[model samples]
Target chain A: MFQFKYPENFLRALGKPLVVFISRVGELSEFIARALYSCVTPPFYPRLLLKQIINIGFYSLPVVALTTLFAGMVIALQTHAGFSSYGAESAIATVVLISVTRELAPAFAGLMVAGRIGAAMAAEIGTMRVTEQIDALSTLSTDPYKYLVAPRLLAGVIVLPLLVVIGDIIGIFGGYLVAVYQLDFNPANYINATVNELQLIDITTGVIKAAVFGFVIALMGCYNGYKSKGGAQGVGEATTNAVVTSSILILILNYVITGLIFTE
Target chain B: MNQENNKIEVSELYKAFGRKRVLNGVNLSLKKGESLVVIGGSGTGKSVLIKCIQGLIEPDKGSIKIDGFETVGTPRKDCEKYYATMGMLFQGGALFDSLSVWENVAFGLIENQKMPKKQAKEKAIEVLRQVGLGADVADLSPSEISGGMQKRVGLARAIATKPEVIFFDEPTTGLDPIMADVINDLIISSVKKLGAAALTITHDMASARKIADKIAMLYQGKIIWQGTVEEMDKSDNPYVRQFISGSAKGPIKVEI
Candidate 1:
């Protein structure tokens, strides 16, 4: 009797991916632990930290502003269209303010930074890994985790909250521009509604989410870059993976944090 | 046996990447202030041997003693004492792009030894002069330098701390013949001046003859043959003959 080896083939096909997935998670956890350990340890590089803060926060402002502004504008347009049918168009300001402050600004800004700074970090570190610069640092008795990863991680954690705050203001202003000038809404009334509807908790939640997103973005970039192999192709793949993984992580964490903060 | 005479010794070194074994029971030793160059074809584990010695890559099983201290599997903090005495010149120079040429040379002094920047800068310029570079090149970024100049800068950085041991990884790989000779001469003079024990890995026969006081040929992850430079010229080992003659017809298969 000939029996089809369905379960056997299924297991064979699934085995490699399962192993890869498990190993990836293990590597990521170990990397994060080492990075965090380095963060609190001595031999800190204040100059590198300041450089990363400027690079990640100050240099990234224009992109974050542009992304959040367009996101806020689109939300206003959509909310106006939907609420006008029910004669609740006046509520557009409240909806835009709450959504922008609580979610879009942080999430969009995180994603933008992920695409820009995350990719750059991965490429730079990946190149350093391949060219033996990281090993050279080791031979020089310098720990790469302390010199390379910790500064970026600290900068990410510190700077993203500030960027998110700036992004929130720009986003709300974008909504105001559309609601008052384009949508024929009362400027004073819209501003009043926006201020009235926004709670301190709303902004805090987004700031907290921004901080976590920043850490995740920098971690993924540094981890993937440090672990890269092969050569130039490996660096390219790492950059892509850093951006994609950080973006997805930001979206996933945004939901998780939102659920935790807003749950009744 | 005088323990002070032997700067580094390796016994039964073994390292494998997954199924492919790169280093299999490799053994070697270097005397104080001696220059030993390992010559092999591409993919013959020459780089791996150097990396193992430097503790950049850990061996699967081995005993690596540097000045009588065991380094294999030693904790990184414990390994620092050995690393502090060592310097490496990477294949591609591997200078940090962010820092200028002089800063690259002074990195260890400033970052590790905590030397003042002004003093480190002076020392950097002094070392640069030793490597045949002028102070004018000090402020330029590494990207601004030529390949040969970059290699010289790398040499400057490697010798900046006056380390007791220096590693050269294919130092002459990407240079013109004249440039390669220039680097080889610089390496010889630098090692002689520093009185540093050196371990160099290369496939360039000309470089090996020029810089090596002793030569060891690595094949199949082992030192198949070793001798002084003159003895290397007259070696009868078929592997050595095949490699030195650059012949396609030999015991060493092309693997293709």
Candidate 2:
């Protein structure tokens, strides 16, 4: 009898989670729509925008720089080792240039920032929610969406591309340093190879990816925090969820965007 | 009895969290410049009632009227102007930790009223002084202050706009006896001074007696009894008597 019900039970268990996931997606889409609507409406807050830009962009530089730099160096070393075995070691510069601009730098910087800034945004907003500070804003006649969410969304869209551009340059410089100093490649030749391999498409793709990743990071952070309940435990869960969801979304979206952009 | 004289009029309010049924068919009203206190035990939906009035939480079914204007289902934009005339002090003070004490107080003036920063700061300082907080404490962060001081700052912030109506949620929940009395006094003086229609929700009977022109006891999502403080002393209702005397064994059962 139990064996006969096994498939039905399995389907039921799957159905519940599928329903939950779909509803969550719906809620998130509505949240994003409202945030975007607030973005386009009047009563913008430049001061808050500037503050968020500083917090999300300027403050994230060290981690982005360090992560991309190390990633680039490691990619250079690994490619060199692989290609040296086949006597194609000179291709190291080309590989480093393409990978840094097209994939590694943006993804690494996004993931790093997701961990740092996403968690912070969730924690801060969750605290505000539980403490009734968000309600206070409403009673004070300030729109919390316009004041909190819009500034963050706009700042993320504005500044992530800038951060990624800087990250790209720093990452390439890391590759250059390793090729010239550690790998015994001539500095001028390596530079020439890197310049020749770099493409407009490569740079543009990274910039676009960075922008989407930024939006995802900010969105997950704000959504989780704003919806958080209970208390300290709720905030803690929200922060963790923000970081995890944004990081996963960064990776998944990277692949999706890459596929879409590169498709014929 | 006069609808025109009522500052707030709520009728048949219903709110439920899932199947919990937090508030059921509630009705109440506050007259102009009158301080009405809602008393209830834990989990009794007093906060929900106050939040529903503030437009922070939309009730499932109800009519909430401010100055005879129906507010339920009104668009936030249509109601924006009304918020300018209203103020709230949250249970936990709810001061924005990111902002300094003065900025917290002056938030409504600078943001909603578009007053200049310097003028708002001066106003905040003056309001802070009124709350018995010194001007020196204005520049400090809310975290640097004690719980009592933070409550005072919250009160100052609530009254900074000189609102026509004010709501306080658990105004004296976390304070010592002396500090609670001080807050009770501040609340009384502030409401009197502003001549604002005030609604406060708290379980603290002492604070309620000190501040309320009318006291209503909330039980299981309904106002079971309402009367003046003097009348409350002589009420025959078992719930009212039990609550007033703070008796554990009574018609009101502790959930535990």
Query: How does model 1 score by TM-score?
Result: 0.96
lDDT string, candidate 1, B1-256, tens digits: 6767899998899999989999989989999999999999999899998898888898999899999899998887887888799999999999999899999999999999999999999999999999999999999999998999999999999999889999999999999999999999999999999999999999999999998989999999998898998897788899999999999998999887
How many Å off is the CA of B41 in candidate 1?
Answer: 1.0
- DockQ for each model: 0.84, 0.86
lDDT agreement of model 2 with the native: 0.92
Q: List the residue pairs that clash in candidate 2.
A: none
Error of 2 at B171 (Å): 0.7
- Each model's Cα RMSD: 2.2, 2.4
Q: What does DockQ come to for candidate 1?
A: 0.84
The C-alpha lDDT values of all candidates are 0.93, 0.92
Question: What's the residue-level lDDT of A165 in candidate 2?
Answer: 92
Model 1, A1-264: lDDT tens digits are: 333478766656677888788889999999999999999999999999999999999999999999999888989999999989999998888888888888999999999999999999999999999988999898888999999999999999999999999988998899899998899888899989888888899789989999999999999999999999999999999999999999999999999999998897
- In model 1, pairs of residues that clash are none
What TM-score against the true chain A does chain A of each candidate get? 0.94, 0.93
